[model samples]
Target chain A: MTLEILAFALAALLMLGGAAVVALTKDLMRLVVGLGAFLLGVAGMFLYYGHAFLATAQVFVYVGGVLVLVVFAVMVVHRANGGRPLVTSQHDIGAAAVAFGVSGMLVMSLRESVGGWLPESGTSGSSIAQELLGGHLVAFELLGVLLLVALVAVLLIVGPGERR
Target chain B: MTLLWGFLWGVAAVATIAGGAILGVWWERKVSARIQMRYGPQQIGPFGSLQMIADVPKLLFKEDIVPALADKAIFKYAPLFVFGPVAVSMVVIPFTAGWAPLNTSVGVLFFLAVPSIEVIAILLSAWASHNTLSTLGGLRATAQMISYEVPRSLAVLAIVLLAGSLRPLDVVAAWRWWWMPLTFVAFVIYFVASIAEMNRGPFDIPEAESELVAGYFADYSGMRWASFMMAEYGAMIAASLFGAALFFGGGWPFGGALGVITLIVKAILIMTAIMWVKWTFPRLRQDQLMSFCWKALTPLALVQLVVVGVVLVWL
Candidate 1:
């Protein structure tokens, strides 16, 4: 049990560390690498949660899909420019401060409201599916619609574009 | 006893890697050859069963070269990144009852998650090579993987819904009695998506040999190229294993040790089917590939998910 806890902690740390690297990296490609690491760590967390399906989905979708898109976009945009600039203006101090403040407040509020209580529901994959399809059917259906809209939007954005 | 189990697991994994690669390569050649109306590797050994063995030593002894301008560090490690996770994923894949080396509740997830690392390895290899075509191939691969991933996830989610557990064993057990129509659809989606993800024929735009030389590995030669091939074949086998485990009641029709053999047989059958598709179908244009996933497969998967949800509730 202690070992499991340690493993979870390690996985969480790895995820946060990767996210920090992604947030802090100056190099655009390096940022993508960090994001990949972050996703991998999240996959580890999913494994810890005994949700291999979710973990695998996270790997297949976020790490494989999102990271690849980001890399391709970077390449495309970079090619449009003569070459990628070595440095950009480090002018996001204000934005960072606002983000930090918002995060702090959100964390504080969560702590105050929930008081460190974690749900102990032994909701297996089947039970979760039942809940999603039965009681939360409307919300589930709404997510499906949202996904469809997103798919169409992606097509419109990416398809039939002029080759640069 | 723990050490003995670990040793046995290690041996099983090594055998799986070597044997899977050998069989997958042979099957791919034979299927492609048959599709092209030619005999493949018939001269070497019985039905060319030993051809892959002959190629192994040649590949191993070949020169490992690196371009002068390439990032030496990443170039050296990229193949490991590609190959390691693939081997590791087999740990969680149960061939027969109580036979998995690293059986966990999240077995299916572990199996699925490991292959994404291959994308990173490819991207890094492309960048490290510092070649124009290689870079473009890497970029294209990334785009392809990302675009197809949505439908793939939805399909897997549908399976998870049906199985009610994340373990691959559980998935097989769930399908033992009766195959759900929704699960069957999910299986088809999963199979197609897995093929695309592996960059097989039709979806082999990233590595289109005639057009892009060798795609992302255009600059790679000798052992580096071999590593990439090994990874691709490993992934093919892994995907086949996953498909067999989930959709076909893995290791069924055979009991105990024979079940493991049966599981391999199932995977090989799937691999051959994929190869047949590869050799028969012409490659899809890049835009067509994207549209197929986003426009066609994605919606079908979504509808399947809804239908499954409804069926689960009412039935």
Candidate 2:
């Protein structure tokens, strides 16, 4: 029980710290890295909750796919050069107030709903297959089509152009 | 006790990779040397097996350079990101009958997914290096790795489909004599895709020595640079081990202590074949490599999946 709690706390800290980095940092690259950290923390949360499949999927998909693209964009598009941070945030009173209010609401809501929510350990991999292919089959296949469309669009955009 | 055992096994896994990497490098040099008509590394050990012992220290103790423009933290730490996943992957390979060191039910996914993390590591190192050649190398490597992953996963999909479980133990548990000739195409696809994934010759456009000048690790020096080599060899070993279990009957013909030996011997044969192919084949051009992965390998992998499905259904 203690170990699980400690693990949960560490994962929460990672998510919070990563969020803080994304919120506070000026460097675009670091912001993407912060996002990666936040995603990994979410994976950690899934891991400690006995959903190893979900945790692995989280790492495999988000961290592996989206994080790479975002990082690549931050590097190439911004030309983030020689340690001078890109993607600077404008300091504003309104943004800070909104952030604080949002976090406060989250805390209050979580505190209220924290009881009787945790699942017992050890879900099988078949459950994931059933959930994705059985119950969510339409959504899953649609996602495939969506990604295929995006791929074709990108290829058409990049393909057989007059040399840039 | 389980946690302690996990810790110890993790340590053992890393140690195995490190030790295997030493022999791997030496053997690669010797093999390449023989292919090129020369004696290699004869001074260190009987067959120059210990040559890496002398070489690793030289690399490690040499001045570790961080280019002036490099991102200090990311540049310094990228090797760990690169090396760590490859090491963790070794845990799931079934070296004994009906068992692996870490026998998670998601063993197969663990094998595939965890190594994808190295893409981030490679990119980070590339971005951090801040050198144009290194950046170009990094971009090529990232593209190549990501592209090759499609076919690799698809190739492995056939094995998982046939085994009916993702666990390495289950995969090996269900391995039969006929599956060898049956899954040969999948094995070849897996083999070719894996070689590409590891950035080896014929597919090694990333670090094409004549073009990119050591590729993404161009600015890395000494131990830092060696870490990338270690990662490469570690990945090769892990991939070879897993391929042995998936395609070849790992730990077969006997199921006890001898099974482990059989598995290792099979893995070593695969490793040797990999080296032979690396030494024998010429490197591909960047466009050629990309085209081959998309147009050739991925489709071939898909076809193999269908064929395997048919075979499994009927037979």
Candidate 3:
């Protein structure tokens, strides 16, 4: 249990560091790298939670898909732009302080709440499946619909936009 | 027991990486040669089995060039970023019952996620190179992966619904009794999406050799290039393993140790089939690849997902 806590703490620190980099960096490419690192750290956290599945999914989807998209978009838009040193505005500092403060408070509250709650005994793979299928059936169905809508939207956007 | 399991798994992962890399390279060359109407590496040992081994040293010794304008730190770390996740993903892939290294409840999810991280490596490599062609290739790859990933995830969701568990072993067990039509559709979608996800032909627009001049890795050489190769082949092997576990019923032909062997065999067979497809088909244009994913595959996967959900809940 102590080892698990240490792992979680390490992952959280890495994630927070990445987030700080993303917030502070002026370079667009560096920001993307920071985001990737943040997502990777999140994946490590997921692994600590005994959800290796979620960790991998987080790595594959956010890091692999979204971050890559962001990088590519930056590359395309900034093709001609090169060697321009990134400049951070003073407003960003104020925004960062607010973000950090709110998150810190939330984390503190969560820690207190977690301390009061009784830990659930080992929920095996079978139990999780049962819960997903039997209890969370509505949410499961909705996810399918949501995915379908997203697919249609993507097609309509990408397909006609190019042709037009 | 955990330590013993870890040791075994480590050995399996290494062997899988080494074997898959060697075999995949040889197979790719032979296929490419046949496609070009020439015998490939026949001079090397036994149908060029040793051809890939000979090329490794050459690749290792080649100059590793860092473009003058590139981000030095990210550029240096990108290859490790690409290679690490692919190796780590091997843990959740169950070769047989009681064989997986990290036998967690979320095996399928874990398997699905590793390849996603690989895209980041490509994106970073491109950005770090600071070259137009590399950046363009990276953009193409990013778009390709994102468009295809939705369908890939949805298809896997359908399988998860049917299998009733995310564990690779459970997925195989669920498929033993009957091959449902929805499962078959899910399998087809998963297979195609996986191929695209791995950036293989005909969806290999990201690394279009002719147009992009080796695409994102145009500036990369030596061990850096080799790392990319390993990641790609690793993904191929990983996807094959996932496919086998999900659709073909992993480790079904035998029990115990032999079961693991059977799973490996299935994965290799699937890899070869992918290679065959790679060699046979012309590469798709970027637009066509995106359309195939968003327009064709995604809707199909969604339908399968709903069908599977309904079957599971109501029927």
Best by the TM-score measure = 2
Clashing pairs in 2: none
lDDT of 2 by residue, A33-124 (tens): 78877988999998887788888878888888778877666656545355555764576678889989999999999988866542333377
lDDT of 3 by residue, B113-178 (tens): 776777778888877887778878887887887778788889888877877787877776666536
RMSD from true fold, candidate 3: 4.2
Cα lDDT, model 1, residue B193: 91
Q: What TM-score does prediction 3 earn?
A: 0.84
lDDT by residue (tens digit), candidate 2, B8-101? 9989988998899998988898888999999988887788777777888899799988888788888999888899989988898988887788
Q: What is every candidate's alpha-carbon RMSD to the true fold?
A: 4.4, 3.0, 4.2
lDDT of 1: 0.77
Off by over 4 Å in 1: A1-25, A42-61, A80-110, A113-118, A121-164, B1-15, B97-99, B156-159, B177-186, B306-315
lDDT for residue A81 in candidate 1, whole number 0-100:
26
CA lDDT, candidate 3, residue B115 = 63
- Expressed as tens digits, the lDDT of each residue in B1-315 for candidate 1 is 555686687677657777777777887788888888989889889999989888988888888888887767767778777777777777877778656678677676667666777887888777777677888888788778766767887888777777777776777666653554447888888889988988888799999998889888888777778778877787788888877867777778666899888888888888888888887899999999988999999999999899878877887
DockQ of each: 0.35, 0.51, 0.51
Per-candidate local distance difference test:
0.77, 0.85, 0.79
Q: Considering TM-score, which of the candidate structures 2 and 3 is the better prediction for this target? A: 2
Candidate numbers sorted by TM-score from highest down: 2, 3, 1
